[model samples]
Target: MAKIKYSPEEKKTLKSMFWNSGLVFAGFNMVKMEGNAFALTMSPALEELYPDVEERKKALVRHNGFFNTHAVMFSLIAGITYALEKEKQTKGSVDDDTIENIKAALMGPTAGIGDAFFFNCLRIIAAGVGIGLCSTGNVLGVLLFILLYGMTQIAARWYLLRMGYSFGTSFIDTVFESGLMAALTKSAAIVGLTMVGAMVAGMVNVNLAWTIKVGKTSVVVLDVINSIMPGILSIALVFGLVALIKKGVKPVKLVFGILFITIVLAFFGIF
Candidate 1:
């Protein structure tokens, strides 16, 4: 198979495409979240690929359909799609349906993996690190989180885009066959869980103010609980919120509910 090479200008345009992926949700809608933006990102390449005005219009319209995935992982799809389009323009063997089918197949798996690794794992760990520092009154914590997370995201996008272009559709098989994806995800999950535990202990605070009265002697309930197990209240509170979330409670409602409860408890001097 012949390799498809990109010029320096095209490479620069691809980098712009990677950065612009974040804007995918800007034109989000019930029908086509990120679809329009995807086409917009591909506009430069499509223009270069199809010099015929009618063909360019057709290519744009073809891409303007329902397409949604994790923003970072979308770079891989973008690269692959660009390669396929290039192949179509040059070889005229690959059809539009084949391109669309490949997209449909890849998007779901990429979203699943990307969400688990980037959203659930990396994001939580970054937040944990930032919040840990913030709790200690370090204002740079927020900046640190943004810089670390943002840089990693940009790097992933750049690498994956190039990988997709270089390997084309075969890259997908190579990824799974190598087992790196699974190992990477598992390692991220372990780190994520560790950060979550640390966050619960360091960030969440809950104390019981009620006192037990016996023969005119008062015992602090919080002190007694702490003597048995430190941060028990915090852990319990975290679990309770997680249970509620699992039970389909809306996050906004849960936040308001917690606020109301905290206020009432504070008023009663029992929290």
Candidate 2:
């Protein structure tokens, strides 16, 4: 919404990227979750910015590195990257590392915002209305959900994508002028970690069912544990799994190990 105008070629490239951003999940993998989709989305921009075939190929390879975020942020990052790429090609200011670092810094915070807003709030509202309609035998509920949640996502993605492109240059310049790149990165990282901690606190639960009897009294072991430190078990369990993961433990093995441990604990009345 700036007092700005795009050239015909810029419009064409952005249009291409807007459509390509929707395929963010295509060919997703653990090693590079959305890297393929990201590369595809940046194709048009890279093609335009780097006319040389070899440079464009290198740009593609560079963009295809371990990108993952919510769909909305995916488009936003692609737009921002497009801006960064243009700067790199034109001003010789932003380098490949700067582009990558900016993407990395934005990914976490954008993911937390996107997921919470879309998945938790908008999706739930849509589902609530949709379910009510469906229960009444009206098919409009399902259609409404799609129209409400899906179309909103599309519109928002387009808007934010353009916003990123329009404002990214100024934002980057401000960061450079203020020498706030490191501070910005660290702050974004803190927000990202806070979001992760909130998720862990909400989702991970250690429901202890252990009990013991002494004389005529029965005591709940979980209560005693909680008295010592509330949610300590759950925190420990989550961190323990995370540690195992960092140690290169395979996910399948981790799942099976958890199951086996659960079964043993249940048998011992310590579930």
Candidate 3:
């Protein structure tokens, strides 16, 4: 990884890759997509880390953005170049230590923003805002969603590229360690939670199939329960699922269990 500085030609190749790959609209799946692209693009750069083709392939698979995985290589390349240049100037040439340092320093920060902002906040913001407007069935809603989604993505590319170019070696220090990161994370969390609230109201599937009759008045009972404990139920459900995952139950199994319960209860008019 020592000789891994982006030459002019390499920069051109990577810039093209970034722009092209960033056009993908896989929503929440963007993290995995970005990771795959990073692994492919950074193969040449990662020769020292994974010298053998088989090893590299394994790394590509292992490093792929599975659950809780997110790191974008294109942006990290900027830090790579900065570190390499600094190392070369200090030691009279670039070496493996420089590349390893770049990887060590940038990996955490990239994963943080790539996972939190790009995959979670940005995707949710775009989809939530888009769906909110689109549900109105007006031409304005369609236009607004398209414009907002496109602008957010474009901003993502621009900011990532700018951070890559400007901070290079110090981007992580400047972005993550600064209060800005906390503020942004908090803000994004607020927005995402709000969106989740909207989604529960608009999208969550909890059927109230049973009814209660009192003195010639028949009312759907589940609706009353839902209205009384909407937020609490949502929080409990999320924590319960997270606990199951922590207890080593697979995500697919959890999904199937939830679906099964929903179906069974709905069938018995008890949902």
Ranking by TM-score: 2, 1, 3
Best by lDDT: 2
lDDT for position 41 in model 1: 75
Candidate 1 has what TM-score?
0.60
Report the number of backbone clashes for model 2: 0
Off by over 4 Å in 1: 1-5, 169-271
**Model 1 lDDT tens row, 1-271:** 2355778976876877776765777888644667988898788778878999999999998998768788888888888888778777876655686677677666667888999999899989999999999999999889989977877988998888877777773543454568664553355455545655764686688867888899889999999999999989899988998899789886568778888998899898887
Candidate 2 per-residue lDDT over residues 55-143, each given as its tens digit: 99999988886677898878888888899999889888777876776787777778999999999999999999999999999999999
- Return whichever of 1 and 3 wins on TM-score: 1
Question: Is 2 or 3 the stronger prediction by TM-score?
Answer: 2
Overall lDDT per candidate, in order of appearance = 0.78, 0.85, 0.53
Clashes of each: 0, 0, 0
Cα misplacement distance, residue 58 of candidate 2 (Å): 0.8
- Evaluated at residue 56, the lDDT of candidate 2 is 94
